[model samples]
Target: MSQWFQLGLQNGNSPLMEQLTFFHDHALLIVVLITSIVTFFLSAIFVNKFLHRYLLDGQMIETIWTVLPALILIVIALPSIRLLYLIDEINNPALTLKVTGHQWYWSYEYSDFNDIQFDSYMIPTNELEQGMYRLLDVDNRVPLPFNQPVRLMITSDDVLHSWAVPSFGIKMDAVPGRLNQSSLMINLPGVFYGQCSEICGAGHSFMPIVVESISSGEFLKWLESQI
Candidate 1:
């Protein structure tokens, strides 16, 4: 399971993101199927009838349509609620990383690693190296071990900013004077990218987030270097 993670948008290299992608793909297919079935039958029944002379009154059809959609919504809500609860849950994490959003930069603190701190700055477009994304690359990347459960505690130094990584299926807001927490079990090994979602200041567009997932041995080496 740990060997298949490749860097991309849909293919999640992290456990939490993999689960989220699977849920999103499967649940969305179910919704589309339900919608298609209802639409096909409704169109088949009403298209010819309305064209001919409207055999059924509009009011009667409207009532059925409204009630049927309501019933379909009930079916969709069940799985959605379950996934939401699962996301809200926080398990016993091995490490905790605290992130604080500043005006135009992101500061990361490895709370468990002798209080190691760093600031991540975005690499400018003109200075992007080979295979590097222009606005997505950062000077310092957060490093963590693969196949480990890591918790994040987030807050803001100024206004509101959101920490979001699409492939990781993780997004949390950093609000002023308030702390928010989330956890992720990154099973796959690779790098993931995110950005500041909220507009705080003029340089908000320059801040970026990078998370590097490495093997346990590599993680320990990186930790030692930080100390």
Candidate 2:
């Protein structure tokens, strides 16, 4: 869960997220440099009385402005395009989880295991226990093994929805009558939370996602118990 006063992005739990954070910093640095330079020029224009008559139609100044902006855009676009392709790239996933979004809740099916399916409902605030996060905790959690590739097949039962997890850098739409797929690989063992980004129905805020990453041995034990 994000705090009210927090302005920065959450610490990432996966490799993609780490790369995204780096890109964010890189873009911010470029923006800051551009802003500083523009501010300095504006201040100089207003404070300094030295005005050259040719400054208005200076060809060199115009050419430098156009070429500099183009070069800056190229610098920004290269890494951005690379990161876009990296996010879309999918490796061999060891497990596939089918996620279905309802009007108010999320249901998951692990077809890789025989008949393992469950619905995840948000835990009511009154029923929440100690250390539980309000509106973020769920009655059922989708578990995945850490350091392994997992693919999610997402779709909606009724209306449109979106499965978004910030730490994983994944946001895929769940449209009715259509199936969408995304991949995730969590390197650390912990709980990651998300929600339906698209507003679907009255209980839109009640639908939350909780993913619990654990060891492969524990995941196998859970699978056996489900069977």
Candidate 3:
């Protein structure tokens, strides 16, 4: 169950997500510092009657303001650009999974193995067992191996949908007649949950995504059973 007072992002389960969280904190710190400084200056002007006659027509002040913002942007931009490239980098994935979004459910295909495919549907609330998460658990959970690179090819069979998992830091659009791809690597073994980000139709919220990361040997055993 999700906590009621959760304030920040979910604990990351992947390396990319860890980096994303770090970047978020880094950017937020800069914003907070800028806001605090600006607020202090404005308060001083009003409260302390601190007014400089040359403030309005000072070239040095204008130059300093302009240069400072430019430098801050550069500081922010460098890491942002690096993260963008890192997310796009595909380093020879060990497994490839094709995901197709339907009007409500999600279908997954393991192309690396022979004849391995399934459809994942949300388990109704009433049918949920003990310890099952409401509206988050699914009938078919996608199994993946920890520490193994995996590639996902996303598309839609009917309407537009988005495949996203916050802990994995992945959100790719699923458009009909178009295949969008993304790569991910789970750093640990656990169950991560996500939902279709795009608002498709009446049942948009019913389609939930669940990924179960296990050991490579266990993943192979599951794959063999599927075949």
TM-score winner among the candidates? 3
lDDT per residue, candidate 3, 1-227, as tens digits? 14679999888898999999999999999999999999998888889755686776788989999999999999999999999999999999999999999989999999988889999999999999999999999999999999999999999999999999999999999999999999999999999999999999999999899999999999999988998
Arrange candidates by TM-score, descending. 3, 2, 1
* Pairs with steric clashes in candidate 1: none
Q: lDDT winner among the candidates?
A: 3
Candidate 1 lDDT by residue in tens digits, 1-227: 11256543455766677777776776688788988987997888866544534435577777877898788677777767877887778888888999999888899998987769988889888888999887888988988888888889999998999998777778899999999998887768888888888887888888888999899899888888877
RMSD of each: 4.6, 1.2, 1.1
lDDT of 2 at 166: 87
TM-score of each: 0.82, 0.96, 0.97
- The predicted structure with the larger TM-score, 1 or 3, is 3
Q: Relative to the unseen true structure, what is the Cα RMSD of model 1? A: 4.6
Better of 1 and 2 by lDDT: 2
The Cα error of candidate 2 at residue 216, in Å, is: 0.9
lDDT of 2 at 158: 95
Error of 2 at 12 (Å): 0.6
